[model samples]
Target: MDSLEQTMADAQARLEAAVADRHAAMHSPVVGTPDGDMRVMVLRAVGQGLAGLRFHTDARSPKVATVALHGRASVLAYDPVARVQLRLSGPARIERDGPVADAAWDAAAPFSRRCYLAEHGPGAPLPAPGSALPADLLARRPSLAETEAGRAAFAVLLVEPETLDWLRLDAQGGQRARFVRLGDVWSGGWVAP
Candidate 1:
């Protein structure tokens, strides 16, 4: 709040906290693609100094293809209680097979992994509106072996932020700062709210 350095630090701190705590308001942030589509996605991981962010997705999903073509994205997270809004924009990539994707898939719970096992990718049409998961899987978690089929559809969306805008609102007024990343270094300054 006192300086741009502190503002940057606070933004990173909030993002890190969101990764560790699912209950955090920013845990599920809005991700926007070049196609003007946006969806709320879980915050899977965050790298040191806010270098990168990780999110899980279905490889067959439309967003994956959109991101692959555009190679860019925007993420927005707002915590009503804290009255903070964080907006991030940067280059993005999708990985279906990699150390990061493998580790994220492995770390997922059976129930969570079961999501990738859906009979069809997201937004698939059905004879009748219903869950995409198989009827049998609806009752219980799939075995580890069963989840293997989903690995092909599982993917990790990595966003390396090139810019970050942080805003804090209060009764008095508001504080705002903008940061731009060049290589491993960040330069930023306070801006009008």
Candidate 2:
């Protein structure tokens, strides 16, 4: 492969490492709130392929509202141990109560599904701390079919990245590059680190 392709592949590998890092977060850098503030979200790597990365969130959450208002956003994945960081910019599409969301919800972990089972919406004012799920449901893992009840509150944010930029800082030196999508083409080049 050419140098540019190799750089992009290396970047993707670093991003995958970050995503697979259980100790640290698989995070997105910013989501523009309607008021134009930035929100950082620790997202689960629900899916990553030709469709780009997908993250699951609550339909009533602020992030969903934010994405609805401003589809443009960026995701930053960093692996401290690997000394690699990847920044991806894209347009986010939020899907709820649809086929896309259905599949995502169904694929979610049982404990994760419990988040949607809360009686109140996310960030709701609770009389006390915690998600405030029913006492019974809290003790056990809900079945996949049981999770269906929470489907209405589940949402999937699919981000189609137009640009994927990366930086690798090491003891020896630092390397930076970016792959930008212009129309139907995807071209990449190095940058000063």
Candidate 3:
């Protein structure tokens, strides 16, 4: 709050906290692809200096293909109680097989992994509204071995932020800052809210 550096640090802290704290307001941020599609995704991980953000997804999801083709993404998160918002965009990629994806999949709970066990990808049409999970899985969580079938459909979406717009609202007015990354370094300054 006293300096630009502090503001940037606050952004980093909020992002990192969002990943670890499920109840955090920013825990589920809106992820957008170049195809103009957006959805709320759980925040899985945040890298140092806001370098890379990790999210889990189903490889068969439409966003996976869009991200693979465009190699770009945007994420927006807001904390109503804190009156802060973070808008970030940059290069991104979907990895179905890699250390990152593997680790993410391994870290997921059985219930979480059950999502990828669906016979079809997200948004699949059905006769009636349903989760698309196997009939048995609908009633109970899958065991570790049962989740193996979902591994092939699991993926990690990694977003390396190149720009971050951080804003905070207050009674006095508001404060805003924009940061751009160049290689490993980041340069930023205050901006009008």
Please, what are the lDDT tens digits per residue for candidate 1 over residues 110-162? Answer: 78899998889998888898899989999898998888889989999999999
Deviation in Å, model 3, residue 53 alpha carbon: 0.3
TM-score, every prediction = 0.98, 0.82, 0.98
**Residue 155 of candidate 2: its Cα lDDT?**
85
Which should have the higher TM-score, number 1 or number 2?
1
TM-score for candidate 2: 0.82
Residue-wise C-alpha lDDT for candidate 2, range 104-169, written one tens digit per residue: 776778888898888888777998787568788988998877877888888877777788777889
Task: Please give the CA lDDT of all the candidate structures.
Answer: 0.92, 0.71, 0.93
Candidate achieving higher lDDT, 1 or 2: 1
lDDT of 1: 0.92
In Å, residue 25's CA in model 1 sits off its true spot by 1.2
Question: So what's the TM-score on candidate 3?
Answer: 0.98
Q: Quick one: RMSD of model 2?
A: 3.1
RMSD of each: 0.8, 3.1, 0.8
